[model samples]
Target: MTNRLEQTKALAGEARLAVLTWLAEPDRHFAHQETGKPSEIGVCVTLLTEKLSMAQPTVSRHLELLRRAGFVSVRKIGRWSFFRRNEDAIKDYKEWMNEHL
Candidate 1:
């Protein structure tokens, strides 16, 4: 019971919800690609910054929170960082919620 409450608190942040909503719209959240466009891949931090209209550090902090919560995954290539929704984690969360609450 205590552990379940802790899990709820951890995922209940406003910024984390906002980030999830943003990621829900991949085409709107990601940049245009030469070929596949938004479907090409994950969202860049800079793009997330612009979409959220928040400072880089603020976005970074929220992203870190989400990463810790297992709601998102971060990948780095060269100097750029990309973030994508962790669908499996989300599915697990839903299952837990259904089973427990």
Candidate 2:
């Protein structure tokens, strides 16, 4: 149990935490561009990279971590990938933290 808790904490590192925060309010954090539309599915990776002020690859790595942690969901469109918050998973995580931490 302790190991699992520590692992979970480690997974939500600073960058991933920031990603989750921004993803919570996609409309405010990411802009809708002419090339892509922001919807319930998610915001584009390009917008995320710009908003995060990080390279596309770096942002993608962070997003991948968040996805593995079940904090975000992915939607692949054409050649691009969009991401959005997984509210249910986040809620469960919070509950687990409250109970365990």
Candidate 3:
């Protein structure tokens, strides 16, 4: 994992934040993916790319940053990668904010 400063930086972008928001309640924001449910296996990067209207590499880079930051987790199902929020890590960040800032 990267340092907390780097992790916080990963969460600072509008697009990345949007990604996190969409992932937080994916079923509400995104349609059911053919591979799996949004709440279960996770949301596909391809779906996120379409929704965000960005190139796949850009979206993937954001997801990779979040993964390194421990703000999200990934699962592999065949050739596709799925992503979901890491609620515990998010909670920890919130707690750190409340206590420090």
Candidate 4:
């Protein structure tokens, strides 16, 4: 139980939380691409980097953290990776936080 609480608190960091929030409304935060299209799976790393105004590697690290927390889902298309919010997981986390803390 304490371990779970620690894990939850780890994900509450500002950058990770911001990533989750942006993913909640993907279309609004990300622009559509000509080839892959943001709607197909989620937003591409390029768009996310642009939106966050951060470098690709930095955004990739942030996405990885969000993925570990189960707040984001990734789909690999060819060589490119796309990311979207895991709504169910986010909802479950919110409920658990409400109940536990």
Candidate 1 clashes between residue pairs 3 or more apart in a chain or in different chains: none
RMSD, model 2, all Cα superposed? 2.9
Better TM-score candidate (1, 3): 3
Candidate 2 lDDT tens digits, 1-101: 12445438636577778777887777677656555545566888888788778988998888877777777789988888888888887787778779976
The 0-to-1 C-alpha lDDT of every candidate, in the order given, reads: 0.73, 0.75, 0.89, 0.75
The best candidate by lDDT is 3
Tens-place lDDT digits, model 1, residues 1-101: 22445446657887768778877777775646332344345678887788788899998988887787777888786787778788887787879999977
> Candidate 2, clashing residue pairs?
none
Tens digits of per-residue lDDT for model 4 on 1-101? 22455447648677777777777777676656654556557888777788778888998988887777777789988888889888887787778789977
Stretches > 4 Å off in candidate 2:
1-11, 35-37
How many residue pairs clash in all the candidates, one count each?
0, 0, 0, 0
Error of 4 at 49 (Å): 0.7
Q: Backbone clash tally for model 3? A: 0
Candidate 3 residue-wise lDDT at 82: 92
Identify the leading candidate in terms of TM-score.
3
Clashes of 1: 0
Residue lDDT tens for model 3, 1-101: 53789778998999999989998998887666887688988899999999999999999999999998899999998899999999999898888878987
